[model samples]
Target: MPNYWGPFAQLKEQTNAILEVANYNGLMAELNDALFIDRSDIAYYVDLAKEAGGPILELGCGSGRVTLPLLSGGYHVTGVDNSQDMLDILSKRMQHRSREEQSRLTMCREDARNFQLGNAFSLVIFPYCSLLLFTDPADRKSILKSVRRHLTSSGLFAFDAPVQESLNQERIFELDLPIESGKTVVTLGIKTYHEQKVMLENSLFQVAKSTNKRYTILEYKKLALFAEGELEQELQEAGFYVYKRIPTLSDNGKTLRYLYVCGKSDTDTYPLWHPYMPHNQLPNHVLTLVSGQGCRVTDQHGKTYIDASGGLWSVQCGLGNTYIIDAITKQLSTLSYGTLFAGRGNEPALALARKLVELAPYPLEWVYLTGSGSESVELSIKLARQFWHFAGLANKNRIVYLDQSYHGTFFGSMGVSGLYPAKETVGPGLPGLDCINAPNPDNCPPNQDYETYALTCAEQLETVARLKSDQIAAFIIEPVLGSAGVVIPPQAYFDRIAEICQRHNILLIVDEIATGFGRTGAWFCSTHFGIKPDIMLLSKGITSGYLPLGATLFSAEIGNRLLAHGAGIMHGSSHNGNPACCVAALATIDVLTNQQLIKRAREAGHYVRELLEQMKNEQPNVSGIRSLGLMAGVALCQNDHKPATKEQVAVIYELLKRKGVLAYPAVSSVVFFPALTITDDELQTVVQKLGEVLSSVQLVNNGTRMR
Candidate 1:
């Protein structure tokens, strides 16, 4: 201590100077002492900028405090300030950089309240409590208005301000930070309250031993302190959504500062590392989901959105159910895994299979389990072929599916799907798969009512079956088409297809990946039409998204025949009937039965249909609005009732997402399959937002209006 204090004892010339704060007053003051300006927490700004994914607009970019770091991090930054001297100093610092690095930083002496760059920016940041400089409410509104215009479609605007939690309490702080060799800055600050704002007055002493130089300066600053939750409300009224509010700790370990991250109300889309997607089309950083409760999921940045599609139309019991979680936890802790291989078995698998037989709406059955819907569908294809081959009809092995229908993406399942786009990429799938027309009442041929259209499409199945009558092993169809964009045909359509399969001696397979588990107002939508398929493919809401489980259910007769043939169903999965997953399915089924969610789905369906009627009346772009049991689709079209182009449907999807109502985008329609447990009020809100957005995009094309 003695050596440290006495090292700079040599006499030197004394100097006095005043170092003003960044925004002293309304872009009026000049910072003459740039070297002594506060430079704390500059790294925090840089990290936040990286999260935002710029081009960035930095307000009050004094002394290149946060700008240089942002530029170095590969972000294009435009620094705006009202101080010419500050801009000049920052400009001088940039002189040594190469052309490319220099191009990343833009300097301008413009007021934050009003400036027009004539372009959009992804992130607009006001660092270092600069937002507090705008004391006037009008000034704040004007600044936000400008920011809103300059923001991109999904852009964010962030700023920080002092919380001043200890305003009335007396506070004293002394800080000595070493800058360079033999030089130190010592600040003694006294905080006082004036006009309900914190005023900081400090005496700074700078001394250097190598040059024997000494300097003393007086600094004074005042800020309009805001209360917690006060800024969030103001931001909302200014057309910005409060994304996150973070409290930053002070040097004394007290949280006296806060950072408010905000986004425009029209913001949409974030970085997501998606599978089976082109990398160039994805965002820079995927959304970090933190917690999910009910149908809503909260991301890491504190943004919450409803999973209306029931997490791929399978979250039958909603999410975050304590009973389901407890069941999985208990099973995992006791017996995490067990499989149906080498004659091995577990209690959960047998218990669930027994439960399925009891709950089934058809004749007594046998159940085969797998890990996912694709696996189940793939197994169904194999089982159908196996059943025929064992029955002495080896040539009857072709699979048939309704046109525009989607089963799964595995080779056999994909071969049976009629979705051309998905099949185009992985073409030449399993060979003998035939197609039949799926009923689409909305797009009925001219002068044909829905019944006529239904019959016309259903007859295609008979046509294909007659041509390849003995060659077709089974006819697979979704009671209500799911991945082809929520297409729901009339009951007669499925009934006719079932009748055809029965007559042709081909097994009828129901693919219920999206429509099973009480999603369509019934335990199984095939029951809604009063018909039973010879075989059924089930997954998705089976585990309510808690775990993966797929099952293929066969009638007693087919099960007996398949088992009687020599080697008793020569198929086994590594994870067939996984105990933990089976337990999850059991819990999910218990929840479905105990909560009476299926009945509520029907009730909510009526509520949703009424709302859709209103939407059809108000939104000119809404041509065909279909709603059944909380599952709906609003197909866009020309006034002539022609299907809208795929591009237009994508645009509608973007608009809905920007408004925070996420819907599945289909070929030419937006799929609306909210959870069966969704409240009436939530349904109403979704309809209102979707209707409002649809009404806004009144486009005209091909000599026809959107309606």
Candidate 2:
């Protein structure tokens, strides 16, 4: 039997036509007609270039579809192609243009895989399936590495490649492919399939009839189909930060393509956010704790662990509070659901909004409700972009986030999150989001002072803005670093970060999802840092674990801007502002304020930390203990100064669970997040259980067990 993969492989080798016949103008025309390029796509690319602020370079510019338009729009563009014929065509096109337009166009003939321009560009584009040419993984990695070296410190690199599923099936030959004016008789023959690289080679025969004469042309094309995790790994290996992967404008499943936008790593700035773990993982243990009076929870298993982590770091009044339960029950009986679109209003939502505005820091008057933290983050991005449009800075749409920060996991939010591992499996996400290093007091670089580290980390925001000035719409962060091991920053960190955002006119979005509603013993974590952000992301604690809800609290300035412009922010989830959820939040807030759980959380956190510290001192396996309010991380030490293995950590975790103390193991450390309303006795018991587990833990090194 003839090998089908062999034919495609041979076809790609034979089709080496110089793309010179396709000029920039011709390419644009093809894109406009063939690819369905519209005003929105143009606007998005233009804004991307503006934010990217590049002396731009287009790798594999083949006929200049994107480069020419950008040049015509007054952007400095350098078009690179290995084929001299293509560059000749570009040169001719540039010469035909006016002198001013010609000045912005530069052409270079070089292999994209190894090309270097001796300098970096603010933006580098590999448009129109150009990335498909590199069938070798090493070549792709090499091209990305070279591209990374050619990018300005804060510049962006954008490209599009075919999706794996789109080309996974066997290629079929079509007799005639419809085209404008006439039908082009076309024949496609797959010659080879390189399964390792997911690349296929195919021969295309175009037979066009003109003046009743048949003209035939045979072209060999290499179609490289990128799997979900492949491109990201290559980009990472090449030193480019993979920021976004947007779906292709063309919805044809057969030609699935994604737009990848990346940039160079700069200094750490925004809070590192966590990517969303898929729902398929272990079901979130929802312990319906029955409680009353103050904040307390007893699980159905008849085991009660003081709420330390504060139900998902929210649940300010702890769990099973009567007021919140009653409020939710009452609201459910009346109006359970309502939409918040097109001027639609619900009484409970309005009341909750009003109450949030009253209690929010720094005149946060505009309230946007979401179903979860991820949704809230997405809304915040939309609001920032919309605000920029409203303020006539439509070009500023890039957002910056911190490294290792844990934001809600959604496609848009995941693009901004720094936890690469969680997002690695998921396919391409949104574009134009940037990340910087975050201040980690626990893991500060040796010899660097905390103040210096904080300033240096915070200043990365300004650096990113200056590098990509006029393009940044907002800087989002969490007041206290959560998820990437709860690494708290110095007191001056957030204050300086706020100042940097102020200096750059960038909207500062504080993700208080895990730190708000008295999680840090203050109404919001920002209060602990003595700073107020332009927007506050509140969730988890708002309803004290009774309902699912999140809020994007906006400042009066932004609210007035939106209202004055009559701009209705068209972003919300279906379950947004659920009446029952809102009522739960309202009642939870009442309980938190009336019963003073925030104060208690503060006092309890102090006591818990002291106990954890004493336990650490007595236990050999316990290395470090850090706490902020009710949130805490216990770092397990190794016997011989080696890092604790996952299996070792798992063993410790199993031991703790067996002792009836439930805790989460994060990477190499065990997280101790009990409820805020945990009694002093319960706190001691947790400390004792943790200590017992550590003391009994058998240290195994090199297959030998040690006491």
TM-score of each: 0.64, 0.57
lDDT of 1 by residue, 593-682 (tens): 899998998999888888888788876667777766867877777554567777667656756665667677775688877777788888
Please list the Cα RMSD from the true structure of every candidate, rounded to 1 decimal place.
19.4, 24.7
Report how far residue 62 has shifted in candidate 1, in Å. 27
Q: Compared with the true structure, what per-residue lDDT tens digits does model 2 show for residues 454-538?
A: 8888888878989998999999888766666667777777778777788889998888888888777888777777777888888
Model 2 clash count equals 36
Candidate 2 segments whose C-alpha is farther than 4 A from its true place: 1-307, 420-422, 640-650, 698-706
Q: Once model 1 is optimally superposed onto the true structure by TM-score, how far is the C-alpha of residue 247 displaced, in angstroms? A: 46
- In angstroms, give how far residue 157 of model 1 lies from its true place: 15
lDDT at 610, model 2: 92
